[model samples]
Target: MRVFRIAKKQYLEDLSGEGSRLFGGRWNKKGMPMLYFSDSLSTSLLEVLVHLDFKHLTKDFGYIEIDIPDNLIDTKLKLKDLDDNWRDNPPKSITTNLGTAFLKANKKLALKVPCAILPMASNILINPKHKDFTKLKVIKVADLDIDSRLIVDTK
Candidate 1:
């Protein structure tokens, strides 16, 4: 399947998930780095906007397209199928193990999805870390669906 990830130009070739681990995201706290991806490009755009700490937006970002065989993904934890409030508060035990495993193995094993609306997924916790995490195909977008002031630079 094809998944999309929006990131800065400088990070276009970086998929180590180290950047995310260093900077905690909405789903995982500090020390946990997950390679976030979305089923929809529009959804990825929404995530980039919402996750930013600043209000204004002038920086340009690129869209990365990844092709991962469905068979390779082992969905150990599916937050989308959960009934509890997985967004505001995710299960600690699961997140902890996934984080620890990712740190050790380097490959993604679990899919941490907070909600279906976001359509987000990450293989940052995969076991037996992948050597070429940044080899995924990428498309630079100079103009997105939103206003130019909001985003630009899609190549």
Candidate 2:
């Protein structure tokens, strides 16, 4: 698949480390026409936005960034190989407040979504750790009917 390099770069910059997005990462007024993320989002979240057909959003789009929830949890698994367990087991319903917010926000966007993706962002680290938060496995592409209520059409 073709990648939007610019968008990818902007996505990474906003989510350099652990932080809260100023305003839900709606647009890229500060970054390079990019999206944003906060602690609530896992790398998987970036992956979701990076992918998917955003043709309607703009042809200037570059990449889809994501936040993978529960990355640190997997890091605690204590695995020898990088792909030890090699499983994509996401928990049902998000537990964190931010996660719920993200789900609700994305759920509204899902109306326009045509599909979903998996980033395999969960894994154990030998030393150090990513933020340890439970992953949220919500319904993909279930809310594609993005109307005025779900998301405000700024365009």
Candidate 3:
């Protein structure tokens, strides 16, 4: 299975999950290393765009395509499996706790979860500590050109 991650150009080559670990995210708490990937390029873009602003708009950005063996992703968490407020903006503990547990368990390299921005779409969470994490393959990485319309002059 192929997954996509959008990030700054310089960090595109760094798959260490260090950024996510230090800052945490909707799924993982601070200090937990986890890589977030979207099923499609468009979704990846959207995921990054939400966290970006005009200042970040001018910076170099890129996207990465990673290939993961289908069998490695044996676990999935559907929308129905989550609480009604799972999509809350601040991200409730229910969601983070669930993800934290998954990472601690280290039972699977990848977990299929619903995207909060677009529930119809899905995001893949990767546990860098997983034993089979090395099985993930980085197939492609290239510059991402964000639409000018998406940027606004704050000044």
Top candidate when judged by TM-score against the true structure: 3
lDDT of 3 by residue, 1-155 (tens): 99999888898878788998998888999899899999999999888878776667665888899999999885557788999999897889988898889999888889889989999998999998899988999999988877778888677
Q: What RMSD does each model have against the real structure?
A: 5.6, 15.3, 1.5
Which lDDT tens digits does candidate 2 get at residues 108-141?
A: 2111111113323321111101122223222111
Q: lDDT tens digits, residues 1-155, model 1? A: 56677777577557666776787554455676667777667777777776664344445566776665555555555654444443443344454454555456545443434433453534323222455443444554343345665654454
Q: How many clashing residue pairs, candidate 2? A: 23
> Model 1: how large is the Cα RMSD against the reference?
5.6
Candidate 3 regions with alpha-carbon error over 4 angstroms: 153-155
User: TM-score of the candidate numbered 2?
Assistant: 0.23
Off by over 4 Å in 2: 1-12, 15-20, 23-46, 49-53, 63-74, 77-155
